[model samples]
Target: MTTHERSKAPAVDGAVLIIDLLASSAFPLTLSEICEKTGLPAASGHRIINALLEHQMVALNTSRKKSYCIGAKIFQVASTIYSKQSIIPFFYPIAEILKNEIHRPIFLSVPIGNTVVVVSKLESSLNATFNLHIGQTMPLHSSASGKAILSMFNAKEQLNYLAGQKKTSSHFSELLPKIKADLERAKRLGYAVSQGDIGQYVSCIAAPILNLRNEPIAAISTAVSNEFLTHQEARDFSKKLIQAARQLSSRIV
Candidate 1:
């Protein structure tokens, strides 16, 4: 007789909730199916679906029982998120290669405002790597993947970002110089590192995956136990990571 446990986070808008449902679904859903799952009323859901269809954000499966799924517009937009053109289709190959070369957990992160969202992750089968999941967000200044992208920003952009970070936490303001220095060094080195920045027992090394405009849209990183990370490992992995980033940047649209 008990209802399902509820989340503490505030509820999202109905339109956004519908979009999220469609994104999470593996297959197209009928109007009723979407409404039932999202708890949206049939009338409101229909109106939202029609609007989405008009904008090419959702497409109806006319051949089927009027089921709906993501549209070409969403696909076009997704093609350029964290990973260029398409996150998985473009990044998975490189992720596999990095996994083979580095023997550690590889993660792909996209910047969503001040935080980075984990889009795709390849968990290491060796020695139990970091237990992170897809859709998890990490702070821009507190994680290696985040730093890799942050370092790609121009001087003005970097300063503005540091100012924002400093605003969020006065404690980090004292370390702003060192943080900026680290990003500057990473730009020159073509890779970034997080040594006990996110946690004491874990560490990461990352490189930014850029676009045709030379702006970073996402980052790729390998995670491992702090004890396992060494100077030699970082150097070797960094070289490979830079190469991978360059290759991906060139190949993406």
Candidate 2:
């Protein structure tokens, strides 16, 4: 079988099956419960659980009676995967150039698991302004980086990502329709914008970065203090932002 086919193979081992069931549960389960759910006998389940716990793949809740859950090791593995797959190494120099050219903060963000995380940032050299740094995460519905990335997803994926997050206000219910309209607009305009949505005093413009498969793997954005950009300045800065994003995208897969 091809590597892709091998990667897609279903789980066969008892421990893996138990882990899958635990992942889908959304809540912790006890050892007995895991065995019950997987229809495994007690001795077999105990052995699998012991092995998993030894590797820190499964964790026992010390405060509860035999309660178990997925462990921090899973998150550690996820972080490693994200770090290795990151494009920040390729994008940072471009971000530095954009920051120098625009005199504003330039940020590179990727949708990691369920959150859009800033992996790299070039802060404005100007004496005073909003400060955004690496490792910050923004609301998927409110930030330009989030919108630019969201524009790349299909309707179902976009809706799924937005589900369950608290809206900015009761009026924020209107945001989904607005976001849909914005996505359409972004597709035509080649970039996205956030006007004081993430921060009352800051505005941003962003464009998507696509991978080898033409899937948007991330976004690059430039944010300026609202006071620093007049209406005409904002428009001009957006053009520059779009140009920078296009250049950055070309460097990626």
Candidate 3:
């Protein structure tokens, strides 16, 4: 075979071997483990692992000693791509306006795997009581921001997702019916609400942000102290939250 043919052959095999190893449960593998799993021998596996590490496609877990895992570079690329396609920047002005109008903390959240992670937050200038830092993850069955995103999925999908959570609360089983009912109500009202679910004395209202294909990709929410809003006031804030979410969705698509 030609030199080009010989070079291409191992490259294809190495790529496939790397992918297979990554897909296995034996991840965060040491060099020995990777060699054994891929049948690539020590020297070959070392070269492959080094190449992946150099590209930041794989990472070393120094704390775990000799373990390797997926790297933050993947997420960095994903965040960059999503930001380019998202309406988040476009909706900042409107989110600020909503914060002023509702006099509450406003937040924008997007689904990352099984969790809803906060991407942006606007603090309430009026009270300054409740605050949510960006990058915080909320429970799907509890938080209004999470429910708004969960509402986009069907019942079976939602149940399957909840089942996969290792650390589910006992409250989840007791409140499943109520959670379903709330999701139904949210669908009709175009938003969702939560009271003291994630944090004591705090309440939130949220609505979904739909993508170009009309699928829910993210959510926007306003959070406040329970003392700040009465039942009726909370309901009204949910409406404003829906409006803001709709506005943001429109801009993205």
50-161, model 1: which lDDT tens digit per residue? 9888989889877668999888988887665534437567788888888888788788888989888889888777758565678777888778888899999888988888
In model 3, where is the ten-residue run with the lowest total lDDT?
1-10
By TM-score, the best candidate is: 1
Instruction: Output the better candidate (1/2) by lDDT.
Output: 1
Alpha carbon lDDT of each predicted model: 0.81, 0.75, 0.77
Ranking by lDDT: 1, 3, 2
Candidate 3 positional error at 45, Å: 24
lDDT of 3 by residue, 1-253 (tens): 2333345567557645764576454547787877776667788778877887888877887767898877676668768855764566866899899988888778888887888888877777677656577667777767898888888887687778767653446566667788889888887878888988657888888999998787778899987777777879877898788888888988875
TM-score of 2: 0.62
In candidate 1, which residue ranges exceed 4 Å CA deviation?
Answer: 1-85
Least accurate 10 contiguous residues by lDDT in model 2: 1-10
lDDT, residue 196, candidate 2: 82
Which 10 residues in a row give candidate 1 its minimum summed lDDT? 1-10
Total clashing pairs for each candidate: 1, 0, 0
